[model samples]
Target: MSGPAPIHVVVVGSGLAGYGVLRELRKLAPDATLTLVTADDGHFYSKPALSTALAKGKHADTLVTTPAAKMAAQLRLDLRAGRGVEALDAGERVLLTTGGPIPYDKLVLAMGADPVKVTIEGEGATRARPVNNLDDYRAFRENLPNGARVLVMGGGLVGSEFANDLSGAGYKAVVVDMLSHPLAQLVPQQVGDAIRDALAAQGVEWHLGRKVVSLDRADAATIATLDDGTRIEADAVLSAVGLRPHIWLARDAGLETARGIKVDATGRTSDPHIYAIGDCAEYPRGLAAYVTPIMAAARAIAPSALGTPTEIRFPPLSVQVKTTAYPVVLLPAPIGVKGGWRKVSDGSDGLKYLFEDETGRTRGYVLTGSLCEERMDMDRSLSAAEAEREAA
Candidate 1:
């Protein structure tokens, strides 16, 4: 009889994916020796809450419902915080870290992503802030003066959310970006227009079709010079350009990586013993950046990690509008899949856009305002289409 199977497991990263993996593993293999490692403070909070943090009057500390100590205690797991991974030895199944090398029967990389950096010339440019983690938020909060003039760079989701939250927090917020509207690439132009109008009413200024060329320190304020030579003075500048998957380590370790670390359906790397998930892992089909897909991947990978035969296919996610003001819902067309959008709009108050493929089957949809009434029908249609595709 085989002695008790190797009981060691090492999970990297402390974000949602890492924690979720641990949570699922504990339920399935309670006797397994589990060790979690992370490079940052191990506080646990819903990261999606960061989008509306300031507007909800919540500080980073308040967002953390479970501290790292409590999490480790509750799960009966060993937790390592503020430790950076040095390298991966796939052949040996060892993880090299600042603490030391850890050998594991299974290894999970939920490494997450890093904020993209933007470079601008000027004195305070080097000091410009990007809030990617709790420490960064704390640093920004400490450095920001009361009643400060804040200039946020970018017009995407994070930038728009930051602008709204900061303005709601009583800061004089100004957002500058090259895009014509907020969430320009993600949502349709009509929806963008509505959001722009709503945000403008809330005192968020839009600097569309403009880029900051330089940032300099001017006495107590920072001066941001646009490409067109227009100068805007602000107390601080917050850069929210976007995020790129942290894939350098994976790449250096000789793992296949593109926009993200490439992983199979089971989150397995090129080496079967190692696996990846969350924002850091990229599916061959495309990047699914939302939390829903991350959860799906984790659920599928857990059983496989425990040596169970589980073949699960990720289903297209049902997107719901979390913002109460606009009351919009969308199921975005999957990436790499071509489709056409059929739209019917009633000014800014009601709008519906359906994305259908070559066969006239509904693959995705977007509904806003009163048009949300057809969501059930749209979902049913898509579900039937998916079923048919599976059967075929």
Candidate 2:
């Protein structure tokens, strides 16, 4: 009699989450057969590093840590590169791709999110690059002349970080956002002001509480008109508005999806044989688009996918704001949770704010500058459950 067939696992996507699970699963079950499929060339690179790479002198070409073939060889898996998964059939356990139909005992959807499109009218509007990936970064860098003035739309984490990076890289950065302050998605007003001051010192211009309603061309320059009738001209436009999870794949396959592909605590999708992880997945803790949660989910997902169900849980974690001028460690307040940020400390040492709920429970916290060292204390106090719930 022939030996039992090896467990065949097909992983879609070539990003961090895909590697995270594969790395773990390989160690656990070396005999398992793995197949990696992706739309890109499958060059391994860090997504978060794109914003900070300019200052570090790293471009798209240098950003790739490993090539796809090497990754497949290292992980001992079948590499299917430059193939887009067109459709998925849950009942048949098959995936329709650009190449052909591929069958697997288990499937992992790690296909990431896409840039949230923004509506801006006028001539230069189409010139804006969301800069969400290496390709966009490459194009942005090529178009950016030395000391170019970049108009960054959105004062959220990505925009603020890019502005900081551009400033550090000897370029002028002008930021615009409808919110009253930078990092308004999470940080308190005072913290935002501090960041504003820090970035201003680094030569970053701010246009808070205003939206770029349109973009026009002036001579060789791009002119951005704000909602309040304020016009600013720059060399290039970079968008950092937001990102939306890829749900069409899961939805087409009849898998449940919300803000993202819905997954249980163990990262298993509605279809028990199929699983979702990374930015594409909205798990029990919520939408995990960051590294920490994705890694954690990957750990639990590996064993569970192999017939050994593991309860996925998070380790102590906090998302760091990457403005080197004034660094920040923050746990964003949970959505639908009533809470208010209260100052814990602020002075020459830096700023700290604790997000407390109506019940006086510390739900989240933000620490900046010197106060960032206290991240461990904050991490310990913030239960892993609460941290997982809110930090994502």
In model 1, where do residues sit more than 4 Å from their true spots?
318-325, 347-349, 357-361, 370-381
Candidate 2 residues 1-392, lDDT tens each? 99999999999988899999998889989999999998888888999999999999887899999987889899998989889999999999999999999999999999889988898899888878898777788898987899999999999999999999999999999999989889997989999998999999999999999999999988779999999999998999998998899889899999999999999988999999999999999887688678988898888999999989997887555898899998999988876788799998979888889999999988789999888999988787777556566678
lDDT of each: 0.80, 0.90
For candidate 1, write residues 111-161 as lDDT tens digits. 888888887887778766778777777677777787678899997877877
Best by TM-score: 2
TM-scores for all candidates: the values are 0.92, 0.96
Which candidate wins on lDDT?
A: 2
Against the true structure, candidate 1 reaches a TM-score of 0.92
